[model samples]
Every structure is written in C-alpha cells, then in structure tokens.
Target: MRKTPARTRSTSRSRAAVVAVAIAAIGGTTLVGSPASAAPSGDTTQFKGVNWADPRDNYADDPVVLSGLSTSDTYAQTYAKASRVISAFRANLGANTVRLPINPYTVNGPYWKSYRGVIDAATAHGFKVIVSYWEGTGARKDGFIDDPATYWPMWNTVVKAYKGNSRVYFEPMNEPHGYTDTEWADLAVKWLGTYPSVPRNRVFVSGAGYNDHVTSVCADPRLKGTYLSLHHYGFWKEYATYDQWVSDLKERIGNCASRTVADEFGAPMTTGLDYNKATPDNNSINFIQADTDTFRQLKMGSVYWPGLRTDDTYSLQKLIGNAARPWLATTNQSGADRLAWSWGRGKPVSP
Candidate 1:
C-alpha cells in the first residue's frame, strides 16, 4: 500500500522526524516526543515483539494509511493518512510490540475503513496488539474453503472496534498461499475455534511461504497452540549467511514445531545516509548484521523496515538512527518500537 499527503506525509514526515530526532541524537538517550504512547496497562507478558516489516507493511507516509488513493474522493485523504500513521505509531511505542496485517481483501470493508485509525493507535500503544485476521474468503464469507469463517464475523467487528479489551493478538493469515498441509490444518482448526476463549496464548500462527520451509502450518495436532509465529526473509541478500538465516530458522522451527517467534525479516532501504557521522556504509548492513544476529539467536521479537522514510539501507533503526547522530531519533520514531531491546545483545536487566 502507498499513501500520500503532499507525497507520503510531507515527504515522509520530513524524513521521519529526521529519523526521530536521530534516535535521541545518537543514543545519548533521553529523547522523547509524544502525542501518544500509553496503552499497555499490563500483561500478555507484555507481548514480547516482532514485525520489523514484511506484511508488517506500509511505510512511506506511515501506517494507518489509505494509500495511493483510489478516490471515493480520496476518502478524506485516506482518513487523514490513517490518523497520521496511527498518531506516529502510537507515539514512538513507549513500551513495545506492534504487528498489524489483516486485509488480504478482508471482506472488502474498505480495507478495514482506512485501517481503523491505525487500529485505534495500536490498542493505544500498549501493544500486545497483533490483530492479524489473515485475509478474507471464508468460502465467500463463511462456508469455508481454506480459511475464513468470515473471521468470526470480522472479529465481531474488529474485536469491538479495537476495544478488544486484553491487548489483542491474532496472526491468522500471512505467508499463507493457496493452502495445503491439510488446508493449513483446516484454516487453523476453523479459526482456532473462532476464539474459544482467546487464550491459547491469545492466538498466534505463522508459516506458509518464508515460514521457514513449512514446518507443517503452525504444527497441527488439531491446532494445539502457544506461539510459533514465524517467517524468514532468508538474510535479505548477501547470498545468505546470518548463520544461514539462523541455521535455517533453528532447523525450521526447532525440529518441526513449538517455541518459534522470528516473526519477520529486513525490508532493505538504508543505502548510504548515516548523515556523515560515518561507518554504517550501507547496502543492507549485511542484512543489518544478519538482523542483529537473528535477534541474538532468537531471544526473538524484532521489527524493521523503512518505518516511514527510506531510500535504501537495511533499516534496523537506520543504523541506530544514523548512530544517533547530532541529536535526534526520528529516522522514523515513535521509539522505533524501543530499539527492539537491541535484540538481547548483552543487555540483561529486562526487555
């Protein structure tokens, strides 16, 4: 999807607030901007995290879009550019966790009506928010073909207009192709039994195409679940080698299922622009150091891409907002989703 507002928000919000004030001006820290960032009242174990990008789509004007306008009369400029990309992605994600896919033609409700105010500022940014409904066609809205029981009446109207109480999560479709592996285990056991009390670990599913060589669609056994949410961009180029994409995503889901999370991979954009501070030379920083060494070998939870502005340079915080250069953190901020806990790199203490 592509958005516009004088071309993707005044040219990608002046180049993503200058890469969100240059990531607190090059990691000196203490740089916070707000208009939002307050929704995680607590517990979903604080949604560990993933979705740097890939079906984690839309950037270049930022999320909550109405992109490339097809006129219903540019639906109020695509609902004011999806309410300013979900209030600048829930104001730089104070806590963390985001993921948002759902509309492969989601029963065509106007692409969830301009993606409902960026899914209501991503559950107000306390993100446990996964809401992946995974595309429509429950056999023409409900007789069932591969996956779609009209997503339980469109998640009862998108989990009651994003008030889905408990911080929300559901990765129903993605990487999903035609279907097989028993029709992806009968549309995830008929949409995980249409939310039989939501907590089978609040819904999670991943694997279809980059689903690390298909380890049997969310490892069915009639769909006993917890979390597997996987997808791999196979080291985004450089001819593979980030330990062979984390040793083939840990032998494709640790020997056929259970405990996965990798979620997604790089988007490719940061080519040369560390704004002179130097040293992030560019060309996908070797796929951002192979996604920071596969998020420290799957301590998991990551999210990247041209979150808002990009030319080309394997965006993982645009080389940390261009090495936090000259003060700022907006290569695209709303806390670039809190530097994804720098992917467990000797940070201890807590995520």
Candidate 2:
C-alpha cells in the first residue's frame, strides 16, 4: 500500500468558517449534488471488516516462505501471534470480516501448512475471510500478475483448498490491473468455470484498474453470482471534496450496490486526526466519513485496507508487544470510530 500526506490545514480554522463563506456564495448548501445514488437493498447487513496483512509475508518472493523464514519454534510462535491480532480486531474494531493478503507462491506451496492456521483461527473467531493473491518475489512487484501460465495454476490450488469451506472465500486475484475490462471479465468467467465446485457467490471479482473501478465489471452479464471487490484510497484523488469523492466512487460502483463490496479502502491512521469536515482538503478522515456513509447507506460491505501491515500507516490497528502474545492498538481513534459507525455501533447517518 502507498502512503499519502495528511490534509493541509486551511486558512480558516473551523469548518463553520468555510461553511458560512461557501453558503453565502452559493445561497444554500455549499456541497451541491448528491452522489449517483444506488437503489438501496432492504438487506441492511453491513460488512464491517479490515485487511489483516502479514507483517513479513507480503515482501517474500519465495514460493515456500514459511520454511524459508521460520524454523519449527518460530513457526509456532507466528501462529500464536496471528491469534492475538485476530482477537484484537474482534475486540476493538468489531470487524466481522478480514481481507487476507496472500503471496500466491507461498500459500499454494509449503507455506499453506502454516497459513491455514490463521484462516482457521479467524473462522473460529467468527470472521469471514477473503483471501487475495499478491505478487511475490517475481519479475515485477508492480501489483500486476501477467503470467497466466503460473497464475492460473496457483489459483487452482487456492480454490481447491477452500472449495468446501463456506467461511473462507476465494478472491481469484487481488487487483487485475494488467487486463482491460473485457479481458478481466473473461478471466473471471473462466475462473468460475474452472472451479465449478467452488460456489460463485463465494468468489469476489475485482474491479478493473488496481481494483479502483467496478462499473465495467458490474456491467458484465457473464460475471454474475459474484461480489465486486473495490480498493479506494485518499491518495487516489488528492484534495478531492467529500461530494466529489463520493460521486467518483458512485460512478465506479455504478448500479451494483447490493453485490459490490469495498474489500480494500483506507488512509493514514498514525497521524492524530478526526474523521470530520474540519480537515477537509486531502484528509483521510473526510475520505473515511464519506465512504463509510456510502457503505452504510447503500448497504454495501466495506473492509478496511490494512489491519496490521507492519510499517504501513493505513493499518487500522498495529501489532505491539512480543511475538509470544502480541498486543494490538488502534492507530487512529477517529478512523476506527468511523469503522464502528459503519458497522452500526452508533446512530445511522441518513443518506
């Protein structure tokens, strides 16, 4: 995940300052249009989730990272550490789901022996897990997997492993940025057919362009019976207003509200900031609030980008303490509050 600078402080200290000035200029609500509204589904179940990333595995290039990185003692210790992290997610953020980033090479190979433990623990703790493939130790760490020869077989191994497990989900690929809309749609259709045993509803078809847009994928008639996965970040559109941000998101999502899920979206949480209009320009807080509002109102599920990516500021929660019994701390209070709010912890925000 890439990092972005914090929102710039405006000349006016309070949001009301901008509000009054803008209102006087516009004669009414300064923020003009509503987002391209999705027809809301009566199903109000919100998917409050976070990406529980591995601190070490994301950087590994070897197919069998577990054996390469850890000895017997260390392997057991790492498994124990993951349990604490999952517990923290449940205890603090009330995350009902976790988007697990996987190195296709490692997971499909020897690493699966150890990785399955984490998936099982999350399942036992009652968190829906979406496992996604990332480029590991290859030609380019560009977040695009172009080698179908190696890619197809790796996913075949992954889908086959969890074909019977309803709790564990199979995301064909993380973000298919290499392919165009039609190409990616074709691949998604092929994936469903390849693994007929794995139910289509359990599969997550990623949006085109780094999982940033879903309109094309949602429009595809062939890619049905699957949920859409989207990844949006404050860094994507710096200095965008809340309305502009939401409008852009709505445009990408198009009409697939009920079937779409924001599997990845987040911003810097280490900086001390509240998710409000006070820090308007380029603020992650504003991003969270606007996106959270959309997710809740449209009844679409949202999973935060990273729950525990070691050095990543986007991580909602970080691991502290020893490897034996790791402790998790909330990186950003206001950011976390918005997540809880999206999950229905407080009063609902009207659309």
lDDT of every model, 2 decimals: 0.42, 0.67
What would the TM-score be for candidate 2 when compared with the true structure?
Answer: 0.81
True-structure Cα RMSD, model 1:
20.2
Estimate, for each residue in 154-214, the C-alpha lDDT of model 1 and write its tens digit: 6667655543466666666554443434444455555555555455555666664434444
TM-score each candidate: 0.29, 0.81
Residue 151 C-alpha lDDT in model 2: 68
What is the lDDT, from 0 to 100, of the residue 9 in candidate 2? 18
- Among all candidates shown, the one with the greatest TM-score: 2
Instruction: Name the TM-score of candidate 1.
Output: 0.29
Show how many residue pairs clash in every candidate, following the order shown: 37, 1
Candidate 2 structure quality by residue, lDDT tens digits, 231-322: 77776655777787788778878878778888878877887666743456655666777788888777778888777777666777776776
